[model samples]
Target: MSLFTNSNVTCPNCEAVVNMPAVGSVNADRRPDFRDAILDDSFQVTTCPNCHEAFRLAPLFNYLDVGHGQWLAGLPASRVVDWPEVEDDIDSVFQASFGANVPAAARDVADLLTVRVCFGWPAIREKIYLKGVGLDDVTVEMMKMDLMRRLKDAPFVQGTELRVGAVDDQAFQMVWIDAETEDVRQRFSAQRALYDAITAKPEAWAALRDKLSDGPFVDMQKLFLGQGRVAAE
Candidate 1:
């Protein structure tokens, strides 16, 4: 049951033979090794020796529900109680969702993936460090619905998802939020243009762009929520 003890599993990047060390037998606490977290001070990191690929490992394996049907164990963000870089268990959501190339595209701005907004930097720092709202997952219409949902008891935004962008987390942050003004929408759309240019499939790009252009610069949150599930959010 050890995470690092996969007797038959080899390093995906280096093809080096490896084995997962079993943590404990049945009915054990099943806690992960905190060595990496101590080193990370509570964050996780992974690097591929063969490719120099680096990524946060917490989000990737944190979603795994492999222990005794205890789905609740992995629910809250607080469950990430350790920090360790296991190249064997590197975050693969990006690779599986948007393909492996996204790591290169995102490496430059990884720390700034999500930023907390505030009147000042210190306030922003405190809210993010303690409160932990996802900086990269913020969206216009999504923000509106979320605000109205908690503050006003309002309904969710219902519309076609227009343009989507990877502001941070690998989740889709919609653009239909009410607070998004024209300028914000335009900037969001402009970012989409970058993805279109990088795609290997030019035809898909044209088709996507044409479909995206159909409306008069509409909110993309409605158009792209589920469709761009594969796009790095």
Candidate 2:
């Protein structure tokens, strides 16, 4: 079941406080419109009654799409620096809800879910978009690593990210955007062959793949964020 709780929020534009329904969890299988809203970037948008300023709430909830084989913990962008701790918490939550702690019946459903921890809107949206388009996310992250090395003036920086804005058979539409503000810093296309090449040579990327897939936070950025969480045995 999808759950929402009314919470007070301060408007960024106006100093007015307003109450709104904040999502606690999303069951996309039951409410696909919620999924649609998320894809369209409209989920949890609220208008301040006092000043009528529009503001979006940072995602802080669990999203489950059984048919898509995805189970994600969506968190605020500010919390990404603490991913090690956050990943541990998400692991515990997944365990209680669907891992060993759950009944066998639930475990059957859990087996199909690809668990992930995403920070901010762009990060979470990229995960869902890649799944919907049948793209391998691990390879996609590998592509970003390659791009960082190849692009002479790539705008790689803190609080910004490279995400797949769209994709097709020929190429992936990529955007380097501010994770918090959703501002597009740059736009470019990556050929499908780049992803295909990486997919074809898994042996070369085995060690990096292990590190990226060590936790639910399978993003390449984790590599730059100091010594990350130790890989599970």
List all candidate RMSDs to the true structure.
19.6, 1.6
Evaluate all candidate structures by whole-model CA lDDT and list the values in order: 0.29, 0.91
For model 1, the superposed segments whose C-alpha errors exceed 4 Å read 5-44, 50-53, 57-233
Q: After superposition, how far is residue 70 of candidate 2 from its true place, in Å?
A: 0.5
Q: 162-190 in candidate 2: lDDT tens per residue?
A: 99999998998999999888889999998
Clashing residue pairs found in predicted model 2: none
Residue 25 Cα positional deviation in candidate 2, in Å, after optimal superposition: 0.2
In model 1, which range of ten residues has the least summed lDDT?
A: 68-77
Per-residue lDDT over 35-56 for candidate 1, one digit per residue giving the tens place of the 0 to 100 score: 2231222333345455554432
Off by over 4 Å in 2: 230-233
